[model samples]
Target chain A: MIKKILILSIVLSTFMVAKTPKEIYEKNCVECHATLPSSLEKMFMSYIKTYSGERDTKIAIKTFLKKPDLDTSVMSEVFLDKFGVKKPTKLNDKELDSAIEYYFNQYKIKGRLN
Target chain B: MLVSRSKDINLFRQSEKVSLIRFLVLYTILVASLLLLISIFYYQSQEKLMYAQYTKLLNTYANSQIKKLKNLHHYFPQQTRYPRSTKFKSAIYDSEESRIFSLLEKEPQYFDNKIYRTDGKIHLVHTLDTYYLGAKYLIIEVDEDRTWLENTLKYILILGAIAFVILSIFGVFFVKLFLKPMRDAILLLDDFIKDTTHELNTPISAILNNIEMIDTSQMSEKNKKRLTRIDIASKSVSLLYQDLTYFALGHKMQKKDEEIDIKALILNRMEYFFAIGNSKNIEFILNLEEVYLFIDKAKITRVIDNLVSNAIKYNKRNGTITIDLTPMGFSVKDSGIGIPKDKIESMFDRYSRFNNTEGGFGIGLHLVKSIVVEYGFAIKVQSSLDVGTQIYVDFRSKGYTL
Candidate 1:
């Protein structure tokens, strides 16, 4: 039992290391979205078109992630029916906010034109 | 003659000054209002030209932005950034006029006009033929350069000043041109009078001397009466001749100041006018105090003579003339055809006549006023029409003595 307790402590300590926002987003959001037909950049474009600003777009995405529902989904009804509604995220407010921020920076329509 | 000519020229200068001022005021108002109207139109057109130039440049920027937006839409997965430029800032709006994104210093408050200026920056809104990244309206903003406006205003001010100066010079020339005929007519009248007065002096003196040599004591009553009329007529002509001579040439004469008893002078002038007064049945009433004055004797005598002559000439038949002399001054009040109230102010003006019925030139009062002014004496006239007139010469200034 003492050996089992020491092994548990070692695993928890390894999990305790803080991840960057980009890493956090990739580990949580990209992993599941990789199976979806629409790309993550395409979803971000729909949010940007509908929400139209950095703050509103991030809030809308964060809200949808925290409580996944058909009514709150930015995806079309056909797309949702094919892929099924996403389950509610287990991430807390701070982690969800950081992930949304990283997602917005990666795909936002700024500074890319030649 | 030279002195009188100079005096006439001085009078001409005074009238010219008055007319010049009047012309300058009207001319300045006309030119200034015209300049202001021109400036307003110039500024508005300049502003329109500036806006047109800037709108053309901004439209180019907007087209480039549209091109960039199209490229981003074609490579949506690869393009990670939006386009920006240091030359200008921009924003986009959807078909419903909601802002998509803005990098502008100030948010646009209106979208109706294609181009407008606000907060010192120019904004141009361009509509895209296709929705480039859901942007139906692309708004380009740039700093509004004001160097053109500054240069325009500077040119307007400099040109306006030059125009005003040139117009003012023309105004002076116009005034001189307008006054030429009037000055020539006045000088002609002056020369005519001088020549006429110069010719009359000898004949008037000769007539007076011949009339004084006549003796009517031994003649019949009818002859004596006729001779007395001739003497009186000759004396009147002589007095008129003296006044004309003085009016034309008095300024050139040297002043001979002396202390004279004014009482004796008034009494002597009354005796001289006795025949003329008798012809009109006018009575003389004297209230003389022994007053003396230090002045040019000929000038003072002319003053007294003109006052007494005018009194007799305007007096009604059986009317009375009252002569009052004191230390302060003297007044000659006549029960005559008194001057009208409106005509009283101009009574002392040369050749101004209110009564054409009186047989004399109208230079009597003007000559009196000239001498009075030269001696720094104040003269006043009080009159009521159809009743009487009183002319007072106050001598308490430079001419008065004990």
Candidate 2:
């Protein structure tokens, strides 16, 4: 029991120190989104098409993640019917901000156009 | 004859210079406005052609972007990076006119027009049929190449200068052409006057000499009055002839300056006009102070004769003629048909006649003015209609000795 508690404490400390925005996004968002019909980039493009700019797109995505709502989702009703609304995210504000920033940077269309 | 014609032309040129300048100004403005209009049209056409070429090229760029986006959507669905190029900057807008992505230096404010320029950069907006990457409007921007504009402006400047030079040459030719008839008429009138003056000289001298020889001492009062009238008429003709001769040839005459007693000169001129003044029952009141001046004798005589003659000619019957001769200047005040205030300013202009009832040419005061101006003297006139006229010649500038 003492060895198990020491090992658990070490793992918790390691997670606290080692979790970057990219790691957090990949662990929390990608784990579930990877199984969806649309890729994470496709959903981001949907957000971009609806919300347009970086700040609005990020706020929109964060709002939907914080409180899963069908009215605010950029996805179509057909897609929503196939795979119901997503669950609200459990990340705190600071963590959520960093994760959203990482997600925006990952799929943003700026600088990639030839 | 050729010399006289050339002299007449020179005189005419001097008098008509103001007219020529007016014509040149009007002509230059007309031609400049025409050139400006042509330049504007040329610039607009050139800009339109350049824009058409740019629109075609930018449309192709937009088509290429659409193709790339389509390929990305179909084959590279998981591709994390968007396509890009270094040739130009671009932006994509969704169906709702919201920007999906942009690499442009400036965001476009208007989308109604397909292409436009702003901040020295050209932007071309092309609509896409397919919503590749959800982009409904593609805006392509590039730095506007201004070499064509610079070249067009240079061409316009060079052409405009050449056209102006050509037009000025034509304008001068047209002005001369337009004035040719007037010049010919003036020359003809001048020759007629010269001939008339030459013919009248001998007869006038003969009449004056013959009249002086006639014995009026033994004649009847009526005969004596007739003789005096003939004498007065002949002298009037003689004075007119002298004025015409001077007008025709005064510029070519040599100056003979001498010191003369102005008081004596006035007295002598007054004697000459005494009979004419007497015929009108005009009284002469002389207020002469001894004054002397060094000037051309003939020119000064003309000035004095004109002033005295005008006083007599314009004076009312039984009117007073006041002659004032001072060290500085002289004045001739007459109770005559006074000049209107508006006419006084132009009274010294050649052939400017105010009283048509007066029997004399209008050259008297104009000749007086010419001689006064030549001697750097000033003339002042004060007259009121139906009251009287007074003319003063200020000779202080000529430094008259007392």
Candidate 3:
């Protein structure tokens, strides 16, 4: 239809070209969390999967990232001592949502194992 | 005279009505618009606030449900469906929108943070994490009554009404206060006019009466000519004086309407203005008819005096001033300099004289118009430049009883 072409042409003309959530995660987040992709996602999902639901898990991760300290960390004291605590992220809300979505899609154990 | 003065007051009131209407319309619209906008914003914020409270309530219920599910999972691992909340109906779904556990049978239409209504119930959908046992979406449905919304709107309506009443009172007071200066000026002008006319009454009567008492036949022809000039000049001033006196005492003027003979009254008024016409050698052609009219004598006389004198004043030298009267109406036709078409419309306005060469204040026709209107009659002036003018007065207006 004419509508589809017009929309496509507008997209091309504007050239907004936003990065995908995965690409955004790799670009801004992976360097600090892990040298390899999916490493942080694996560790976070193992702890988060025990929560009441996906919303609770997403909220917990988001809250922890906002102000990371020993009290809020889900990791064992041994792991926390070895890896160190996570500092506040420089990423804004949009980037954070993208990165979190990328983490969920990449390494939630149910999705990866199934 | 009272009729003439009332017309002036009517004119003043009419002029102010426009400004009053403009102020009221703009003021009310502006106020209403502001109140409406505020109402919209308040209602929006109220919606958010109420929902926030509902979300907090739902969140508490959600946490309790989560804890119950955790214990149920720990002990009853073989259980298939998650437990439901007793406070409200609830359901859970997987990522594919397939219901994993639900209390209600029918599924919701949309999944968003805001509440939606369906099947006579209100519900809100929330996404929960920690996937305690694999559920992605948790929906909370409660039977919501509209009494709260109605109460909110009722409060808004009351607020709007209060603002409208308060603003309207202030608006009227402010508008009137703003026009106070203009009202005072008009009142002061009216007072000055009454005092001036009151003072001119005695002197004008004295001049007219003494001039009448003079024995003109005993004087030399040359002095007689001078006396004739004085006589015409004095008569003109006396006519103006009568008009002003009637105008000043309009409110105090007595009204005594009775059956009067129109034929005699017309002839008498003709005789009254004969000398003024004679000064210019203007001839009178009378077509008087015997007609009875129920009217005040003084007001009708003023009307006739004005029309006849105007014909004489504006007539050419040795021209004819024709007076025609029927049972229905009368007309004063003159062989004189005619009025321009543009000037005729405003000729009935006080002091709106178009013909400046004539010696009189322009109050005559305006006074005549007032009396005509009062008596339910119609008058029209037809004129063309350099040809002539005809002033017609019909006894009855269209749809008038008499």
Which predicted model would earn the best TM-score?
2
Cα miss at B174, model 2 (Å)?
1.8
| CA shift of B250, model 2, Å | 2.4
Ranking by TM-score: 2, 1, 3
Candidate 1 at residue B171, lDDT?
Answer: 84
Superposed model 2: Cα runs more than 4 Å off: A1-114, B1-14, B72-80, B94-97, B217-220, B384-387
lDDT of 2 by residue, B3-62 (tens): 132335354555678877888899999989999999999999989988999999888888
Candidate 3 to truth, TM:
0.63
Tens-place lDDT per residue, model 1, B303-358, is 99999989988889999999999898999999988989999999999889988877
Q: Show model 3 residue runs off by greater than 4 Å.
A: A1-114, B1-45, B63-83, B90-125, B129-137, B157-172, B215-226, B279-281, B313-318, B337-362, B396-402
Identify the CAPRI category of the predicted complex in candidate 1: incorrect
Q: What i-RMS does each candidate reach, in Å?
A: 5.4, 4.6, 7.2
- Spell out the clash pairs found in candidate 2: A112-B82, A112-B83, A113-B83, A113-B84, A114-B83, A114-B84, A114-B85
**For candidate 2, what is the DockQ-based docking class?**
incorrect
> Per-residue lDDT of B1-402 in model 3, one digit per residue for the tens?
222333244324666888889989999999899899999998988777777777787777777777765564343334445576568888766555656566754568887545666776667787765554455677877776677689889999998899889999999999889888988787777767776776666776787788889998799999988877887887777788788877666546777888888789988777768888898898899988778888888888889999998888888999998899887788999999999999999999988899778767788998999889988899989997777899999986643323
| Docking quality (DockQ) for each candidate | 0.07, 0.13, 0.11
Candidate 3 chain B has its poorest 10 consecutive residues by lDDT at B2-11
